[model samples]
Target: MREWMFKSRQKLLTAALLLVSAAFAAAQDGAAGIEEANTKVRSYFEPGTNLMYAIGAVLGLVGAVKVFQKWNGGDSDTGKVAAAWFGSCIFLVVVATVLQSFFGV
Candidate 1:
């Protein structure tokens, strides 16, 4: 009976060791997956930056049209509206440029 109990403990210890090793292997695979994701995101930065610029351009155009209509309508707050729109467009451009430069991408 004592021998049987000793064998049982040894088997349990071996199983635990196998489980730990498998966990470590899984962790290594997760690290590889994370690295691949990082590479993919970095690859997309240039196109993403360009997309931001394009979006900014579109927003600027739309804002300009709105501000022009307000001006033509003789709205008293046209200047304020124009300044707000212009500020937003400038902010977008600056953010994109800064990100590109900062990342060296």
Candidate 2:
């Protein structure tokens, strides 16, 4: 019985070690893929377009946040502002989506 318990523990330890090693390997591969993608993005080299898209994304996020905040807090003035912001964000997102679809970005 003791020997059986020891064998079972050893098997569990081996399985745990294998899982850890596999996870480490996967993490390394993911890191490498990210680095490769970063290099590719950098190499593509469209600074102006990238900046514009980034700004648009930021604006959209900010607008969404403002909208939610106003909606939750029940501020009338901010409600209008929130609606405007949310609308703009949605519009921007739609435009971005269309552009991405058309341009294959």
Candidate 3:
């Protein structure tokens, strides 16, 4: 009876080990899939970079016009408005660059 119990425990241990190894193999496959997804995401960064720059340029043009209008109108807050617009344009440009770098694109 003791021998039988020992054999049963050994079988259970072997089965658990097999299940653990299978899980590990599955995890490796999942990791590979994740790598593929990462690559796909990185691929989008190129177009996004261009789009960001374009948006910044447009914002800069619009901001310039608005600031010019304010200055022409003799508004006291022209400087503040110009500063805010310039800051936004700069932020857009910097964000694009940072995102590209962060994604290793």
* Model 3, CA-based lDDT: 0.95
Candidate 3 lDDT over 1-105, as tens digits, reads: 999999999999999999999999999999999999989888888998999999999999999999999999999999999999999999999999998888778
Off by over 4 Å in 3: 1-11, 101-104
TM-score for candidate 1, residues paired by index: 0.88
Count clashing residue pairs per candidate: 0, 0, 0
Q: Name the runs in model 2 displaced over 4 angstroms.
A: 44-105
Worst 10 contiguous positions by lDDT, candidate 1: 47-56
Higher-scoring candidate on lDDT, 1 or 3: 3
Lowest-sum lDDT 10-residue window in model 2: 43-52
What is candidate 2's TM-score against the reference?
0.42
Ranking by lDDT: 3, 1, 2
User: Model 1, residue 80: displacement in angstroms?
Assistant: 1.1
- Model 3 misses residue 74 by how many Å? 1.9
Give the Cα RMSD of candidate 3. Answer: 2.6
Candidate 2, residues 1-105, lDDT tens digits: the string is 999999999999999999999999999999999999988875564554455577777887888787788778887788679668667766765676676566554
| Each prediction's TM-score versus the true structure | 0.88, 0.42, 0.74
Clashing pairs in 3: none
lDDT at residue 86 of model 2 (Cα atoms): 65
